[model samples]
Target: MNIRTAAVRILNSYHHQYFNYENKIAATSDGLKLSGKDRDFLYILVKGVILHRSYLDFVIEIAAQRSVKKFENTVLNLLRVGVFQYLILETPPHAFTNETVDAARQLKKPRAIGLINAVLRHLLLKDELKTRLAELPDNESLAIQFSHPQWMIDRWIEHFGIANTQIIADFNNSYQKIYFRHNPVKISWDDLSQILKDSGYTISVAIDSPILFFSTDTPGELIRSELFNKGFMSVQDISQSLAVRLLNPQPGEVIIDACAAPGGKTGMIAQLGGRESIVNAYDISPAKVQLLKNEAFRLGLDFVNYGVADARSGTFPMADKVLLDVPCSGTGVMARRADLRWNRTPQDLETLLVMQREILTNMVNAVKPGGVVIYSTCSIEPEENWQNIEWFLEANPDFTIESADNFVEAKWCDKNGAVQVLPHLHNETGGFAVRLQRR
Candidate 1:
């Protein structure tokens, strides 16, 4: 499809969130043979639009002679995409306007093209929306100006204050640093750093741990190099490695990675605990199990055994240590998963709590009475992190809290035996973890 056609279809599919940020931009630009300028410009346009959506809607409300939301998704998103290019991205009116209008026409909605043109042209002339935003309260101003929801802004302001909230908001609208973990068994960071350097990617340390971030002028697929292929490295975040650290799989102990998939932690467990100890990684999906097994081999960790089993269902082998990095609301990963911000609701917490509690109760049984159950998530929400643990502690008399601060540095932990790593609060990605010992 043409550029304009794709723009219209993107909104229509309602799957734009998965593709919203930069994840799919490379493929999109490649498929379209987009010019370097146009590709960069569109990435800015699309991301800016999603990031500042609420603010843009307010602007549209003020600028349009009539309601803009009354229009079809295609026409509405076109206005957003178009207005985003002109206002935030500073993409020239001629290019952004002509392209968006052409996109509307390509969608077989020439009538909608006139509507898109009319709304954007109105925005260009009136200057009323910008003026109104300037006259509003601080949070309101940031909300409309930045296109974020007011409640979200208020929550951040309450927790982190205005300036840090803005910084975190701005950071979310940018590209994530691509990070990789060196397989401890096969290669050292010093050696892999040299290998990555020769391939045009510069690696930056995430922490004293094995993780490293890189920005590549060369494409990222270059990881197919000998170092990566030989199980010398795997991609992961700084805090992500911490959960495995907490599990501390000994050389001869039995460990289970509940909900392991794409097996970053499973292979890591295999790496640390050594291969012969039987790191049985379990997930409900067989395909996910295969992924765990694949990473095990790639990382040169042979002890990891893969099983398609659900933790909540309690249908797995017992173990000395259990790493339950359960499925979460995914709120902590807003920067990496843009669509998640809009997709999650407060009600999902109830459903998530049921699943979490069920899994915790059933899975803890698989842990030996004296062993540890390490509960973790790539999440910062208390309901999904601490509160659930509180409930679990109250119910499971045999379990006691083992403060995560005991193992990892207490620099970024909460007092209640859990850690909330916000994007603005830590150098690592947003996440939470807790260690519980069965009494």
Candidate 2:
């Protein structure tokens, strides 16, 4: 399939997922057939529009002098894709407009093609688009400029101040890094590096951890490689790897990963703990539990056991350590998960706060006295990060905060003893983790 048609198909898939509450990644993977460069272009067009949807719509509103809702959904999404390409991708206006107009005809909206062409042309004729972006007010402009919900931006400003919020917005609007963890158990880092290099893959060290490696190869190619099939490498984000490092699981100890799914960290624990330690990994979803089991089997991490149970309600035997990697608003990793900025709302944050509190409380009880409980989330929001830790500390007198910097880098941790990995600061996906010891 051509890039434009593939983009449109993926955009329609995003529309269905957006309206029906579906997974955008799963939808894109299932719907699009383009591969390699074409697939990359399709991803750029589709995710760029979604990440900058409001911004693209704002440009259209400025050029067309009307609300975007006035157009049919297909036409609107087509316009969004066009505007994103022209304004953000900085594609040549004539080529972008004409190509979009041609693609618009595929939507069977022949009558709307002229409007799409005219509006995009008008935007093109305007001298340098950046000049127009400078004209709007602060909050309203940022809401559209960054394509983030206004309330989220406001909340970030309240917690992080104006400059940091803008930095965060910039981070969220950009493409994210792809990091892979080499399984030292199956193959040494030197061997993995040689294999990836020989396979025409470029490697870089973005973090201090030797297990983590950054690559230029697409995730699809990496997953299908012999190394991946033989369980020598696994796709994981650096922020998550950092969390596992902070957990500091030791050999011969028992660790319970309360929210383990797909089992990235479970494998990490088992690998790091050598052959002596045991990991009882559980997730609320049985399907996800099965995925963890499969991952464990593939990685040859038999030390990592799996079960399906809700951490908030299920009772489990006490362990030397417990990892409560709870769900959150996922604001920190927006650069990778583009639709999350649109899908998350203020109410969702509030709901997640309650769930985080409940899960933390339950998981803390499962850890033995003097044992560690590492609470983690892929969220930059304080309400879900340090704020939740504060609440947990106040409620659970027996648990005291540990210096997260000691585990990772002291620079990432705040005075409250929790680490907040800001994407703008780290130049990677954002995440948060705080270690606590039971008194």
Candidate 3:
């Protein structure tokens, strides 16, 4: 199949099976034996459609003069891909229209061929599309412009105000950089940097971290290289690494990663704390726990003990530090995970809050007296970050918020002393972490 057909199939899998777009893209790319350029084009088409879905749908409805809901899933996706090419990628009108129509025929959606051509032609004929989009009310306009859910835009406006909300939306729509955390246990920062530089990868360190580095060059080669497979480096965002930095695990301390899976933090803890520290990591999924175990082995961090257990309820060994990097709405990394904005709902936030609280409450008992429990999430929503910590503190008076200033730079922390990394402000993925100490 052609790259465009493969892009449509990946999108279909994401829509029908609710699978992650990244995973679906990877699997489809490999199955098709796509060349580098073909794979990149496929990625652009799928990711572009996902990132600008709302705007594309709006354009489709306007040009077709019918709601998008009436189109079959196949036809709808075909139109989205076509419109993305014409509008965002700015592929020439004739080229994109003809190619998209051909893709529909290739995918055996012959019925959509005429419709696709007609709508795309209609879109070309309409010079007032941009004007109409701009004329929408503020929230509606921002939602379509940024391809975010309107409710999400409303929530951000309520919490961060209109100006910051626009900034956040714009940031989320920008290109997300890939970051990798070097394993100090196996390689020093200088050695890794020199090696990567000698290999022609332009690498830069994160603002406050030496071990965390990012490259403007595509990470495909690095990720597939022996350096990553040998566990000299692991993919992790600087924002996510902040929680581990705040924990500051000591040589003899017992560290518990309550929701560790695909164990980046767990490995970091073991690396920072040395082999003497016992790191116990647990997650609800057995497959994920195995992934954590495999990662530990790859990193040569044999001291980490892995278990498959629910964090919301289960016995955990008492430890000097516990990291509860709970599941969240993932608002912070939307730029990286393009499909997340579409998959999440306000109700999902409500449900996640309850689950986050239960896990936090349960993990509190796992920390020894005077020990710390770092509550964190990759969400920018106030309700999921500080508000949850507030609720936890009010319910459990024995625990008190410790200023993150002692650990991270003051710039990343809010007035309340919690680490609040805003994507717009920090130019990093948004994340939150509060160090809570038990009295």
Candidate 4:
């Protein structure tokens, strides 16, 4: 496809804020028809725009002499992609404007060409995008600096300090690293590393324990290589690897991976504890259950029983250990899911946190006496992580703090008793986890 067509496709895929890296790339032709160069450039262009979107909007809203809130969503997203390249990625000024103008025209937005042309020239001549950004009033500055909605900034400011709100936003603005766990039960680190390297994967050191960072644009399907298919490893975040490890499933125990799909964590429990521990994994979505089934099949593990059941309203056989990697605002994963920043809101977290708390309560009830419950999220917000766990503990004093001293950095003191991982600081997906033991 031409540059204009690519831009148009990207614009059409962006659901204002509900977009994700997967969604943006899902419809693209992955077959051999598209040249490798075209495919590679497509990823770079899409990701570059997605990563720098907030700042790009700040520039567009400035040049237009209008409130960003008033702009058409499609026009705004398309222009943001254009301006992002011309400004941040340093695409040629002529090509940037011409391609984007053509894209706008193709979208039945013939009139927007002038607007797109004017903004690109203004940016190229003045190059004041940064200077203009520096002049935003405190409120607007906070919004842009963090790359979050002003409303979210205010909500975060009300909760965490202004400094912390700024920190949170900055965390959301970058591309996230790749993290996956070494399923020691299947293959040792030494063998796994060799298998990956021999197969042409670039490995980077992230943490000394349990996780490995391998960079490849090879579709996730490549992970199904002979090594991975032989139950050697599974792809998962560093925090999630830690969460399941901390759950510490032992042989002969039954564990329930609530909301388990894609089977990353579930696969770990099976591989970690061996054939003695039977894992009954549940996900509300059938699609996710299939993901679990695929992962289990790939891992060559027969210990995991996959099922589609809503943890919120469904009953299941009792489990000795329960892991609820519940859904939340996904603030912690914005770097990987670059399109999520625009999709999330303070309201969403509020609603999701309530469900998270309820899920925690259910998991607590689900586990047998003396069993453990590890509650986790790919979200960094206190509402989703700390407060919900705090409420769970407050209601069930029978559960006592099980030391999360095994956390990557072990700094839960200020986090109200949960492992809170941040991106700007940790260089991994932002996440949180709390482990509780029934006394």
Question: Which candidate has the highest TM-score of all?
Answer: 3
Which tens-of-lDDT digit does each residue in 136-250 have in candidate 2?
A: 6787677777889999989888887888888899988987767777788888778878888888877786564635656554665677567788898788887777778889988
Instruction: Find the number of clashing residue pairs for candidate 2.
Output: 0
Candidate 4: segments with Cα more than 4 A from true spot: 16-21, 24-26, 35-37, 64-78, 98-115, 127-135, 183-188, 208-233, 406-417
lDDT (tens digit, per residue) of candidate 4 on 1-439: 4654565577566655546555455347353245555665666667766666667767777787787688776677668877777766788988888888777776778877778787778776554666766777766788874566778777767866777767667666655555556666666788877877888876765565444434455535345366656766666677567677678888899899989976788887887678888889999999889878887886778668888888887887888899998988887777666667677766787789778867876667688898888888888777777777778879999998776775445653234556767764666677887788888
Q: How big is the positional error of residue 237 in model 1, measured in Å on the Cα after superposition?
A: 2.3
User: After superposing candidate 3, which stretches have Cα over 4 Å from the reference?
Assistant: 207-210
In terms of lDDT, which candidate is stronger, 1 or 4?
1
How do all the candidates rank in terms of lDDT, highest first? 3, 2, 1, 4
- Looking at model 2, report the run of 10 residues with the lowest lDDT sum: 16-25
Q: What is candidate 4's CA lDDT for residue 18?
A: 42
Write the residue-wise lDDT of candidate 3 on 278-309 in tens digits.
88999999989988988888988887888888
TM-score of each: 0.83, 0.92, 0.94, 0.85
Per-residue accuracy of model 1 over 1-439 as CA lDDT, tens digit each: 5554554454455554344445466567778888766666555555556666776677666666657668777777877777777777677878878988887777777888666777777767646775786789988887666555566678778867899777777766666776666666887767877877876675556565433434444324545356567877777766677888777778889998888996888877877777567788888998778877777777777756777887887577778999999998775666766556666666776788889888998898788889999999887666788788888888888888787776777876776766667778774567888888987
Q: Give the best candidate by lDDT.
A: 3
Which scores higher on TM-score, 2 or 4? 2
What value does the lDDT take at residue 382 in candidate 4?
Answer: 72
Consecutive 10-residue window with the lowest summed lDDT within model 4: 407-416
